[model samples]
Target: MNESTRQSSEPETKRQGLSGNALGAIFMLLSGLGFTVYIVLSKTLTEDVHPVFLAFWRSFIACLISVPVIMRAGIGKLKTRHPGLLLLRSLFGTLGFTLAIVAISADFDLTFSQFNAISFSRSLFVTVLAAIVLRETVGIHRWGAVGVGFLGVLIMVVPGVFIFWAASGGDGFSLDLGTMTAIASAFFLAFAIVLVKSLSAELSAVALLTYANVLSSVLLLPFAIYYWSTPDLETWGWIIVMAGVGFVAQYCYISAVSVGDASFISPLDYLRLPMATVADLIIVGMLPGMNVWIGAAIIIVSAAYITFRDRNKKAQKVKVLTDR
Candidate 1:
């Protein structure tokens, strides 16, 4: 192309990139709002419904929701060469989903902000798992960020546990089930993410999501039945709404990643912490402790730095290859 033509096209290309990034940011914000709604609804319903049962219905509904996509894509499109790996991925995902629900259930007594803050640790867990399982190289910078991230988690969790111990007159020390389950959920979710990264080369997104939801339904069916309590009509309405909102949120997240630079879009996801905090204050009339706010800020900074570093490394590698 001639100099004038290329110069004109450069401006247009920059504009388009900015536009796509703006759209992705909007989608990320909407996703954060949708998830906040879903979590609030789950907390409300868990007043009467069992979390296990709620989890089963969520998976079942999500599976049903995927029907139209599958039909449009053709059944053969769902076939995978790595069924065993897919199953393992689904198992970890199901465990993560169920435990997350349980962590926020009424019986668990965890505030929404606390749950959201802890959930951010999934990225840290992913870094660790990638190093160990994927044998990915971990530079000192990323390792330091991970260390800071765990320190943030400790800041959020340890203080509360100590206060509770003091309240109990220091008779015995025990961590709350809610905190344990929240951490477990993040770990399992990270493992599932690592597996998905491995499988993405061989499977389409539709296949991965469809298989995960379907298998989650199957795996949780027996437990759901054993713990089942029939929901009233009102509860049923909320359950359906929760499923729909969750699906849309998941779609928005996927879209955001696909359409724009992931590093640019990812920090927007931290909006969920504030979104949840506001929703909790308005709906449940509760605020997370000061530690939650402080710790979550630290975790967000750490995670964003990790993402920035990873993006820079990838860009450098691409530049090296192109130079060669």
Candidate 2:
């Protein structure tokens, strides 16, 4: 290729790259909106159906949706060298899904915004788990971010604990089941992520997703059957919509990451916090307390910093390898 032609092609390539990133940003925003809708629907339907049952249906629907993808990718692609780890990952993921639903349900006192805000702690958990489990070097910078993130979590939860204590005339301090479950869900989700990181070396993304959804459906089946209550037609309609929206959200997130750097798109996910807060006010007629706003801001900034730091580390590693 001639120099003038190469220069012209370089400009076109840059334009195409920018367009892809723009599209990725749009997809990330849509994914956030879709997940917010799914969460709001879950909160609404949990009034009439058990959370375990809802989780099973969601997983089963996702599995059904994966059938086409698996068929196209070839069933052999679903095979993995490490079945035990995959199963464990699915179990943690299912637990996370069920607990998250319970946390946001009417049975729990937590508002949608609080649930969303607390969920951001998953990144903090991931950093800690990566250091301990994966033995990845976590610098003091990330450790400090993790600390700040936990402080944010405490900021959000302690206010409610004190409120409960005051209501009890200072007899005791307690965290509500909803808050506890939300935090637990984040830990389990982060564990699942760590497991996925281990498994990704041997399994394709399609296989990983398929295994998780199919295994989650199987794992939750008995519990779902035990807790099942027949939903009215309207409730069933919403359930179906929720599953479809959740699947689309997952697709949008994958699409965003495929087209752009994950670190660039990840912070857009925090959009769900405000989206959920608005959704709660409009749908559930509730607003997040001031603590939620302040705490969520802190957690998001910390998590974003951690994400970028990880990205930079990976880039440096790649650069070093290329320079070699």
Who wins the TM-score comparison? 1
Worst 10 residues of 1 by lDDT: 165-174
Tens-place lDDT per residue, model 2, 87-176, is 989999989988999888889878878899999999999999999999999999999999999988887887453234345432322368
Which numbered prediction scores highest in lDDT against the true structure?
A: 1
List where candidate 2 sits over 4 angstroms from the true fold. 1-3, 6-18, 160-174
* Candidate 1 ranges with C-alpha deviation above 4 Å: 1-18, 160-174
- Give the Cα-based TM-score of candidate 2 against the true structure: 0.91
As for candidate 1, its clashing pairs are none
Cα lDDT, model 1, residue 110? 82
In terms of lDDT, model 1 sits at: 0.89
Model 2, CA-based lDDT: 0.87
Total backbone collisions for each predicted model? 0, 0
